[model samples]
Target: TPTAVASTIKAKNYIKTITYDNSQEDFVEKWLDQVFSEALQIRSDNKFTDEVPQRYEVPIIGFDCLKSATTLIFMNLKSNKYEIIDRPGPRSCPIHIIVKSTENSIHLKFIDAKNYVSADMELDDFLRDIGKVEPCESLIKESWLLLSAIDNRIKDYTDYHIDLLQNASLAKLSCLKKYAYCYKNFNISSCYNPEDKANPFDLSMRYWKSKVNSYNEQDKRKKRRIDHNITYDDYQHFHDVFLTQRCHMCQARFTYNNKPTLDRIVNEKSHTKINVLPCCPYCNNLPMTISNQEVYDSLRNDMRNIKISDCAIRKPYLRIASQLNQKRRDVNAQHHYKWLTLQQIIQNMDYIHVTDDDTDSLCLAIAH
Candidate 1:
């Protein structure tokens, strides 16, 4: 035989399991290579000696590794069993790796054997400790994004509720879904319900009202002085002329001491005679007026000049004016006959000629 070449392959006694604490990187690699080479040598006697077949293209399981860690796991590719290589690392090591196996899968976990302190734990560290498992990072990031969106949506709904409460408008309650969808990812089970007795938004609204009432009370307290010199005659006259009377301009009755200011009085230019009509606050502020005769003359002239095309515009005006005239006639009849109802005097007679637009403008004036 030729000079015998000592094979890089080691003998059967070559250590199948190696453990090292505080081992240099090169030494660890060399040790692993030798173990693998020895394993290969042991199987060489079989017919498959020319081909070293791998059971899996990649390691079936992979996780973090630290020097001096004990308990390595080796897979017997052919047997589909894990060999728990105990006494795997040197003594006085900070970390250990443990391997446990169920029927079909190998589980690896890192154990911190020593009580040595490390840097503050980070997300990455936690991830590494758990091993590079699939889909974990992506799942965490998606969850966080959803949480942030929900938080912002809740804040928006809260602000919207406050605005609606302040304005005393219930119209937007119909759009609860539009507002709620902002928190769609959070699975919030309910939307804002102002009528719900236990709702925090409703409770907060009540609290706000109470605070406002307190502030109003304080303001009243600060302005408590009365002007005693103001004469009853003047007060009574003003009350009669403005407060107790109906606004001649828009025909709204006022019961409060504060009547609509002259600036807000609409249709004030429609009054005429100084003596024929009382100089109510509204009439006194008129820009122009038609005397009784002038009104009759105007009505008669307009009727005479009416054209077919003008009928469209004139018809509405005439209809409303006729209703107003009828109301006036009825009032005069009641006053003349001394048969006016107390209710009519107190609530003011219903004047159906008043258009909705006129009614709204009159209400605003009365509110002042």
Candidate 2:
């Protein structure tokens, strides 16, 4: 709001400080430090003048100025606290005197909803030029989409400007949303066209994408190291065992209790067919943080009694209850004839397909 001080012709002794709120673009604070302080001194030494009524109510002036991003509403520190000054609109000026004090050598800075941009305004001229750089609507929209993709900001594409107005995540995507909303609402035909090589937002988007790509590659490498030997068939076979009965590790009944997963018998060993077993995710994870001296089986079994745990099985987890509807839901035959238990195994034995080589290994597991 210190925008007023920039246009001041003479020096002043009464106005102490000015502040800026950047509703349109961010460059005012820097402009104020490098340019506005001297302007205030000049304007104040000569005389103070306002294009509009100087005696307008502070609240009304503040509200109008914010919408147009024209005037600065500041306090007169030298005067009573109740007296708020609404300065002349920012026509070509960047800083306006929002507040004044008896102690002189005026200073102005920008403050936004988040934080200050800089401590001192050494680069004020460079900063002020930012306000003059008018970016095109199409460029803004294009950059907005690019940034959105990087941030993974999922929202309704159809009528998103209206539909996603209430999204809390929009706050993080403010800059992109600002351009998008502006393009949807305003006529951008007169806005200054950006040069092919000097688009700042485009540069920012490229930097963001680079970081995202680097992170993705690192994550892929880590995943590759973790499951290099675990094949698709191994996973399907593990699920087959888990769906049929309790976890082979701790004998925990599987009613979505930590939902089953495959884990290595020895963390140091590769995920060979013999090394992996169907265990609850919670039991499997114990080996990662348990005592380093403990064997995998000892560590896994130590915390296996914990029945309540969570698992994020991204893949489809199909349940195997043998013959799901072959027989009626006969409560009377629950013991031996008609249930999702072992008796259904008899009816669905053909689906089991126990190979001769695996017969001994599956005997105790199937009985459980």
User: Which candidate number would show the highest lDDT if scored against the true structure?
Assistant: 2
* TM-score versus the correct structure, for each prediction: 0.15, 0.19
lDDT of 2: 0.31
Clashing pairs in 1: 271-289
Error of 1 at 99 (Å): 41
lDDT of 1 by residue, 214-249 (tens): 434543465522232122233334334543444443
For model 2 the local lDDT of residue 310 reads 18
lDDT tens digits, residue span 1-368, model 2: 34222211112343233323344243343433434345444444433242311111111111012323333222212223222233443444323324432244333322121111232322222123322222333433323332233222233322433222122223323433443453343321222212223211111334334533543454466553434454443434544565565555444544432444556566555555676676544344332222222222232222211221212111111222221222222223222111222211121111121112222122101111
Best by TM-score: 2
Worst 10 residues of 1 by lDDT: 359-368
